[model samples]
Target: MLHATGSLLTIDVGDRSVTTTDIDDELAAFIGGRGVATKLAHDRIPFDADPLGADNRLYFASGPLQQSNMSFTGRMSLTGLSPLTDGLLSSNAGGYLSRNFVATGHSVVEIVGESDELLAIHVTDEGVEFEPVPELEDAGVPAVTDAMNDRHGLESEHLVTIGPAGERVVRFASVMTYDERAFGRGGLGAVMGAKSVKCISFDGDSAPALELPNEDLHMEVHREAATSDDIMRRQGTTNLTEFLNDEFSLPTRYYSELEFEGAADIGGNAVEEKKYEKAACSVCAFACKLPTRDEETGLETEGPEFETVFSFGSNCGVDDVVDVMKSNELCDRYGMDTISCGVTVAAYLAANDEFGNAELVHDLVEQIAFREGDGDLLAEGVARIHDELGVENWAIKGLEHAAHDGRVVQGQGLSYAVANRGGDHMYSTTMIPEYHGKIDPEGTAGKAEHVIRNENLNALRDSGIICQFGVGRAVEDDRFERLFDADFQDLLSVGSRVVELERHFNNQRGFDGEDDWVPYDLPDLESSLQEYYDERGWNDDGTVPADRVDAIAGSD
Candidate 1:
């Protein structure tokens, strides 16, 4: 409430209209970022709306902390009905966009309606403009970005654009920002494509004024981050590759084998070896981004992060980190989620026994973007095309599984099954505790409690618009109290409400206990899963209770 502008912007591309409304009560009740976005999507979007139709709205929002100079606050949240999963999902992207978005004088921006022509919508303090650019049809991310820069002097930081993948409505297309950073899950870019909105630019001088309670904490965190020697700052998230492989959960050769003998070839050390310079988003320190280049091969990309490494490297049987790096770049340019795109390629390899064919992997990345030939079938994603391809379904609710195999980390498998976002590891992050041996990774009992707490805590972090690495991860419970000027539990309550609201929305769409499923096995799966629902005070099924929904929406 302190940082919120208490306003929402709605842009209807179909009619070329821009409107604003006061959301004072909603902001107070839901907080900002994911929380506010979820509430808005719940109440406004029709329960049976098609994920890629005009009825499905995209909400882009930043949270209270974005008003401060906090080290981990340089991220934004995008909430929408997922084309891949057919459920509500909130995806986070870290870049310079959050700062520019906050300057627009609105807590959230919603894009609605469909346009007859591909248009770029520009938002500023003064007003809005919809410019039709038919010539830019089928362009990739860089082309759209370069056009925006040349025509409007807007940089990648000021633009959120789609690529050929989105233009073709690839089921796992991604909404890309800062050229490379992505709202990588759930096909929101395809939603944009469906709406005929190719890009949106933000720059304004109407940022709301806010008072910081623990202003010094920002500097303290930044100073610590500047002096820290965290391995993530060197290799990005690839630091988890070898460990996951060692634990027999790396999902090599398309989930057939749990371990990758060549894990070290594409693990953190390999990524770090290609590092040419440091990179960070637009704010304070804690530069944990990997900007790598292979000078001999002339391949440069930000990262083939842990998930990317899993999907394109080990999962596809490719040992060369640079090959994964090229896949990473290809996905970014084409605006596809690397996890989904890589798995699509791997799924093909499974059918053809062509594992480790790096050239085919790269070619598949392009074909998926263009929706050509086999790419057209693979573009449909693993879940939808598995029967035709004659392979084991490796997807949950249509979203491809990430690197952390659920079988090895039993808790994570449970987390993946009941997750609202389907196969998204971040939904609960049970892997964190499992990885640290805080609990038995193989045990099923009592794991639900950890999943519950982590789901809420992560929801809170997304609302804070914070990263989950470096000092962001180290920021403790008490530190959060001073920063938000609110009780830690109270902040977590906001998260609980967000989670409940997501479940409520999905329930309205007919998802229940049956929909929360994983492909592989887990011990006591039904019992532990039911226990999770019981602890949440929901029915025996996974749907949120009617009373709880009212409470989450603040109607009670």
Candidate 2:
């Protein structure tokens, strides 16, 4: 019955045979949710697997703590090889859809083969079925969500649907799982589109039995995070703009300059002052989700988080919060990855002289959504845009323009450059330790050591499916281990260390230590890696010391 953990369901439309199995001991420890799914994808799919081909597998996984009283726990991961990065891609979303795993009594859904017809996979506590989604074709998330509610006759049922962005197979397209919180990032949505799977809906009244070390201890941990100065009590990550723009002065604009004078206009206080509503995920108490209603677009949506605000607001030279909100809504509706989508649009605008024309911008967005004209080129992503448009001024790796100066961030920048998925911020945000405040923001000295540490820590977080916000304070210290019990600690540490080995895995795929080098265009790009390697105790190559690798591998 798949009671304690979730079930893994594999459906082959080509063979018309469905196999369902319980998430077992080996799979649970291998990658947990996100990490484990990546392991499976790497093993199952060939390096030459066409991202949108029938041979690829679309992975959807729910964590163990999903439906419990755990805070901010409604997260599901969709992982596959991305056509954008042409490497591993894993995106996560938060909404009621995660709760459905607990209700429907399953952990992961693995679907294979191409369906000639449009279909939505529906799962209930009773069982699973694939139904045609004629009404949801080319529809955005909100519209599809409404249609699902009407069909199921239950508002509680969560819907994971993609918009035209996904259906069009935009290289940076995302799957909008929850209405607002997306399985966003990477080209996971486009992978689903290639399979002709429109969406997946499920709901049920069920909760798994949680295995807690101690009831009192568990509640105590929650109390600290819920009331801590870092997460709930502070202004939240929304306040990051003020620190980056005003204090650190590291906000990037079209990859030309860092520092935005107009940042104050869109600061966290501005959001709270101008907007009066807030939203949160399924069981989360800390709703950092700031929903603003724009008069121009006549739409209301959650977030414009620090990344979105920076990428779309200041980075693109648009200062109005309302304008940023509209852009945010448009990206969400189109099922586009906000980070990549915004950066790709900005790249085009910066490259094309016609970008100044308001009409051209409108046409570009429309065409990209509908897959016509220059939108075809624009939908491919910044790297592709650089190749097609011959603009080398700026490009992205994980989905973001190189932030904090690609060189100054050291191997962190290396990870960004060669990340299997593309330019990403969260994959390696070691800026905290590597960057000394008020110093040369462009300096790359002593960054490799910090990058390795933070990357491992972040890997642990993703594998554990915990929010970075809750662990922000502990990110630089050992307190990070306090969040989990002893039993899970061994797996977390091993998994964290394994991330680098996987980086080596990419190295075996033709990328190298030289590939870790930042583009020489940035001011400090040349010296960053050398200085970073020196500080990290590496002998020139960015590889970790074998002794340390063995020590970590032998842990627990």
Candidate 3:
């Protein structure tokens, strides 16, 4: 195993004890990050454990590429039972954290049990320390990062933290790192908050010596990133805003409409006008992160990315881009997933007929973080409270939908129905091909195979700890096999195993083919789903067979 540290670190927050064990088998078999983390979670997390309970564990892990510090390798993976979906889930974030994490010399770290008081855990090559942090209870993300830097001399890159939203156990709360980057989709932060954990910081210098297939490959990719004139570098992800809105679906007014009249005001060009600086992750030269500021109002933040444009801008009928930026800042400051928080707020606007009330939208973000007034119900996420609000439930499996309008992008619609993470665009990522005209976007007849391959490939990418934006750029073609020290098909197989592990784990906890669903209808959905199951060799009920489950069980 090229990047194997040959060890695992298990932390029991309750007892403040640490155990390190050999996990070379897992490292080699799963290829670390999402794959290894999923393998561990499938075996260890109790099937019936509450998502926010002490029994639920969160796994933070790294992959081989971290050692290279390559252009797209500055990311890491995390897996756990989801507070939002009540099923197993995994998320990854890109930042300066992965290199620091790999420095601790453990490829995988498992956080389990709960603490009686709010706490922070520090992991280093020397050892682990649990510090009771009662004074930091319910602190916001900025406050925690400042205290960690001021009191402990730990920088933003060294900390993984949750804000007031997580401590309040908001189902859509996010786990943040590098100050702004997030393990964002699932409510992993709520799980941390449920454990009474405030933050965990990493620092060390005992990184393993990685064997690269081609030493110059990273620099080659870095040069490509540095010189590329990708439009995303100019506007970040919001570059897709006006285009998706004009040609496809932007999910206006809580998905009641598909077009926004004011999209130009909040689209990529608008965001570009506010961008004052450039930012990148770790050694990555892509520098695609949006660092925007409104000098007139003295407001600044990282991004109101394309999704935020949909969620807070068009979805809630607010067209002013600055309002969306403020909403983005609040979500980051309070440690919440922007997609879930924005969509939940959009749902609120729909139910109350308050669309376009930007002030109310900002209030909702803070309210959800603090669980105040109507924010409490909204904090439960759209799936849990849509009925009481007398509005259409736009979520699937408790997760609110992203900006990609599945009704227009049919393959993505199919992906949303069956994704383990539920309605998340990145889970299968059919949107890219659909946007590029690579796949027919009007039907699901022959889309199952493509969806399966994409899911598997993304699974491997998460394990690789590679940024998704770098897919076609830094790590495509035969380069993927070379970097991972494996064949193309074999890597896909590893990804398939990871996906099956998650599905099987969630299956045991009462999800099945029935749970593989979408809110809106799609053409030939039934046959496509059958094709998907048949391709994977799963049971008709959408459950992984015992033999396949056993094949991935344990490190052995």
For residues 1-556, write the lDDT of model 1, one tens digit per residue.
Answer: 2445547999988888888988877777777889889989999999999988888999999888888877877899999999898999999999899888888888899999999999999998778899998888888898998999999999999999999899889999999999999999989899999998889999987888767787898888878777778777777899988977886578988899999999999999999999999899878477888898999999888898899999999999999999999999999999999998898799999999999999999988998999997999998899999999999999998889988778888899998998898888888888878888888889677788888888988898888767887323657888888777888888888888888899999999999999888998788999998999998888898888898787666641
Which sequence of candidate numbers ranks them by lDDT, best first? 3, 1, 2
Model 3: how far is 367 from its true place, Å?
1.0
**Ranking according to TM-score, highest score first:** 3, 1, 2
Candidate 1 achieves a global lDDT of 0.88
**Model 1 alpha-carbon drift over 4 Å, by segment:** 1-3, 470-472
| lDDT by residue for model 2 (440-542), tens | 3444444444555566666666665666664564232333344344444464454554464444334434544555533444444446566555654444665
CA shift of 214, model 1, Å: 1.0
In terms of lDDT, model 2 sits at 0.63
lDDT of 2 at 388: 66
Show how many residue pairs clash in every candidate, following the order shown. 0, 10, 0
Better of 2 and 3 by lDDT: 3
Residue range with the least summed lDDT across 10 consecutive positions in model 2:
474-483
lDDT string, candidate 3, 1-556, tens digits = 3445547999999888899988888888888899999989998999999998889999999988888857888898989999898888998887789888989988888999989999999999999998889999888888899999998899989989999999999998999998888899989999999999899999999986667767677788888998999998889899998889889988999999999999999999999999999998899989998888999998988888888888889999999999999999988888999999999999999999999999999988988999999999999999899999989988888889998988999999999988999989998899889999998789888998989999999999898778898987668958887777677898888889999999999999989899888888899999999999999999898888989888777436
